[model samples]
Target: MAGVRPRAVVADDSHFMRSVISDILEDGGIDVVGQAKNGRDAVETVADLSPDVVTMDVEMPEMNGIEAVDRIMSENPTPVLMLSAHTDENADVTFEALDKGAVDFFTKPGGEVSMEMSRLEDQLVEMVTSVAEVDATAATGSEKQTSAPTSSTRTYVENPTLLIGSSTGGPKMVERVLSELPLEADFRVLIVQHMPDGFTERFAKRIDSRSDYDVREASHGDRIGGGEALVAPGGKHMIVSNYRSGRLRVKLTEDPPVNSVRPAVDMTMNSAAEVITDPLFGVILTGMGEDGAAGIKAIKAVGGRTIAQDEETSAVFGMPKRAIETGYVDDVLPIDDIPNGILNTAKAEVN
Candidate 1:
């Protein structure tokens, strides 16, 4: 591992956060090439140092993370990871950073930024190291431009559900796909994104701000509506279940982990299989593990459609590749083609 050390630039407004992130990076076999106190400094540092990865703090002063992300992506185009707090406002800004070009994000784990550092070392290191593998093309948002949906009256379907799952390299993948989709679209979208506790609510809001759909985090017993999208909360399992109201609703449970994660894609898909007698569709995107393979198989068994992100466009190629290998995926598409792929498939499948 001697010559394999990755280099990184750490950017954050909080002195304690910068110190903490830097320390974690160093301990994880990455060289701390530079440290910047604000967003402008982050952009400048990336240009000067050209580190393998950049960690951005979302609420930084001078230039916020979103601005720095745009500048760096437009100019330097390095793999950037953003840091977000548990606060609701920061969640919107945090995912906005991802949409602008930040690779992924991590939440400050504890309720307070206490002296506890061991809680984050492994997870932070793994994410930064995994993220460092992104090529300049993806960091610059290099997927081909797809036309955003123009004026349209989306006819709501009687039984339509879209399921999406992603992990590493997911934030941007999900954001881009959602942004290209018709705002106020006809179907319901459910997402199982691997994230720490307290982040998904804001992530949903961020996607909501950028799209026509009413995107929000799922709550127990919340029934998804037409033209609505729900993201599974961080610490619970989100399952689709039938309510007494004779419609599908989100059920958050404290169930044991599946595929080593609480909000596992397989769990949601399997649960959906039980409650949904409709046109269920699963779109599996980039991530590092085989978390969605079983879920895709489950969906396919139920006669639901499935799409896997192809290897060429996937950042890690692990999760989608596994799903594709299952022979359950009906389509394997690049990131840019996914939105249209889903739309066409939904129209063809749903009544």
Candidate 2:
């Protein structure tokens, strides 16, 4: 096992796609241990082979990817990477798959099958390899539900801003945190969940349906206050800047990606730290990279409070670990305790 390559099972209804994905993995140094033509086969194959990772197609005959994810997580609990198309339906199902315990998703550049598939070679392989290291069993069993805050104190911060950043295994944590917040909470939240185009809008809509705040995808020139939570749009960096009369607005830019990702959390949080005069809070959640570490430091340097999700509950500890190492984070709490921590910190700050 010392010299063995990581193993993967490629699952797709199309033979051509299966071949393409297998070749990509094998060429990228991963072994193609098994191939499945449908979701049912995918579950059985994974349960039998126990590959290091699984590349799952969103749509397949007999059983779709979402259902397969639920079944696999419930029965076998393997690390799964979803390959999704860029349509609204695929976007919706992809999130569902994620909620059911899929590790992460890679968007199909064009359609289900295209020459563009080759373009995804590097990113797809990286995702497959990265997710292979995740402890799927722990992730599947991690608590997803949050309860009411034990503390009854809520302090009103005038025009305060809260910036949240997350990546792999982030959507569920973001949703849970937002849902736990009371309806009257006044933080102007700007969320930077690492995602690609054609997905963030639907993600914001999903969160809005379940949360109390007026959550929506951020648009250029949109004001950043009045209890609104704006999710940074996919494929663009959202930066906060001072507008007329001391008001703040978000500006979307196609600036070069930082940390290999557009819509980078650093881009948004750093900007807000420079411009926002009101009380600020930075929350670093589960992710795979250090994009938010410097942003957390910048927020703390500007006298804003910072919190990070602890490793026991994080799907991936990279982002939160990096932020915690910065010596700037004021608190490191589990996912279940973060909403209350934020509120208590706000109350303590106000007092």
Candidate 3:
């Protein structure tokens, strides 16, 4: 037991894919204890093997990855990393799997079968290894809320700009925070959620369906408007351009990735700090890295406010912890309380 490696179950309908994934895991020091040909077999194999993690294919015969994720979460609750194709349809299904409790996802190189997957060897191994450390039960459970903070008097900043960044367990958290905001709040929001190119559009659509704010994927030269939110397109950096007609516009660039991810929080937040002279808010939620730390400092240097999701509620505390360490975060609140923190920061009377 002392020398035992973390075990995983690779589930895919393609025998070739199963072998490839198993080999990758083994090479990464993770033991592939079992393999499954379909979702049904995946469930049964997981039950029997009780592996530390699972790499699940999005599409399969006799059951799909989404269904398997639901069953696993409800029953065993092991960490699941989804393998999906980069298509509009697969994006929707992959999000469904995430909603059903998948820890994270890796976009397959070129559809269901491709030797191109070998190109993603490093990324795949990293994701699977990181996910195995997650507490699947906590990651999938409903968030607990606390009462909002209050003071005697209230003030507000009209038409404030809100910049949000997140990763890992971010989608559900982002949806929750945005949905809790008042429909009439005068905020121009820009969100940078670490995601793949084909997925951000659908991600924005899903958020818009449940949120009161007008949400859509950001396009180049898109003018910022109060009461609307724009999600940065994946695989590109979104930065604030010059102010025009009393509003700032966002520009998408193919610049090199920051912090190893395009559309990084720091990229957007740093740009917003330089252009937007209004009251700005930088919020870093649950994520696995220190992407937003410098952005937090940038915002605070310009007399803007910053908030971080507290570790107790964070699915992974990496980003928030790094931001908090900068001593620039004005409020550290739970996931449920974060919406209030953002709104309250704008409303809290200036001394």
Candidate 4:
């Protein structure tokens, strides 16, 4: 913690919450350069102070966090960390902020200030430090490309469907991959990330803004289409079903949690495997648990290809490592290579 001290701006409607966050950053050796009481102020503070990072709160008076994030990123792009209420409503706004270019977020505690701040101290510090690090690297134009296997090139499937699973550091990682995808790729993508309710819609919207693809939260009975990315709704399960024409459609379910998560990766991957006979591509990205391993197995069992993020590039290696350990992953790649792999696969499939 002795390197460059990260400077941050805290924006929230709650003065108490702002002070608590400022204290936590100070304790973590980060400089809280400024504070904002609303989204408009947050925007101006960012413009004036140009801090390395901003901790934003949703549902602020005057301008909301999502709108502010949009303005900040468009004008003077600074890394933002959204402060979300633990309620389902706030989670949605938080995800929207991310889609709008904020880096990540933390759920504010529901009750006492001391208890809540204590619980979130580590996460806040970690997110702030990480965003600052990424921004610094980006500013210096020294960000490294993802490391993937060069031995065997990836091959795509005909009429391929892409399935992705992630958690924890997923938002930024997913943004990086999706933003690089071709706008006209002839495949549909499905993503299942473990999150609280109300967040997935915002996450999908965020991705859509940055990506050429049409990204949205999956609705029950929604038809899957090429050039679209469907993010499973949080707190529910998203399954795949076959239409009469043999095309795939999404089915949202309230099924019991699998692998301790309702929107489990295994649930969606298994459903896709059952419905889609063609070669599919399953990707396991940065996350903290083994939720995707079983789903990856289902994909592999159906002769579909599987790829897992390598540990060096993972925020946490649990999910991908589990898939690799199961001997299901066809490739263990770094984050940068993932989009390329998918692209190469899509190209090979077409041929």
Best by TM-score: 2
Give the per-residue lDDT digits (tens) of candidate 4, residues 89-125: 7766666676677766766767313356877687678
Model 1 misplaced stretches (Cα beyond 4 Å):
1-3, 13-16, 61-64, 111-114, 141-158, 179-185, 243-246, 349-351
lDDT (tens digit, per residue) of candidate 3 on 1-351: 456688999999999999998998899889999999999999999999999999999999999999999999999999999999888899999999988999878889888886888888888887787678778988767766543333334456776889999998789889888887765556788999999999999999998997878999999999867778999999999999976444779999999999999989999999999998888999999888899999999999999999999987777788999999999999999888898888788884578
- Greater lDDT among 2 and 4 belongs to 2
How high is each candidate's TM-score?
Answer: 0.85, 0.94, 0.93, 0.66
- Model 3 clash pairs are none
- Model 1 C-alpha lDDT per residue in residues 1-351, reported as the tens digit of each score: 347898999988778877888888898888999999998999889999989889887877789889998999899888888777767677767767777877788777652253565686887888888788877565564567697554363443455788899998887788778878775446678899998666787678767877778899899988876678899999899988873332569889988888878799999988888778877889999987789899999999988989999887887788999999998999999898999888777653235
Q: Please give the TM-score that candidate 2 achieves against the real structure.
A: 0.94
Full-model lDDT for every candidate:
0.82, 0.88, 0.88, 0.79
Winner by TM-score between candidate 4 and candidate 1: 1
Query: What count of clashes does model 2 give?
Result: 0
For model 3, the stretches where C-alpha displacement exceeds 4 angstroms are 1-4, 144-155, 244-246, 348-351
| Structural RMSD, model 1 | 3.5
Model 4 spans > 4 angstroms off: 1-83, 86-103, 109-157, 243-246, 349-351
Ranking by TM-score: 2, 3, 1, 4
> CA RMSD for every model?
3.5, 2.1, 2.6, 6.7
TM-score of 1: 0.85
The 10 consecutive residues of candidate 1 with the worst lDDT sum are: 148-157
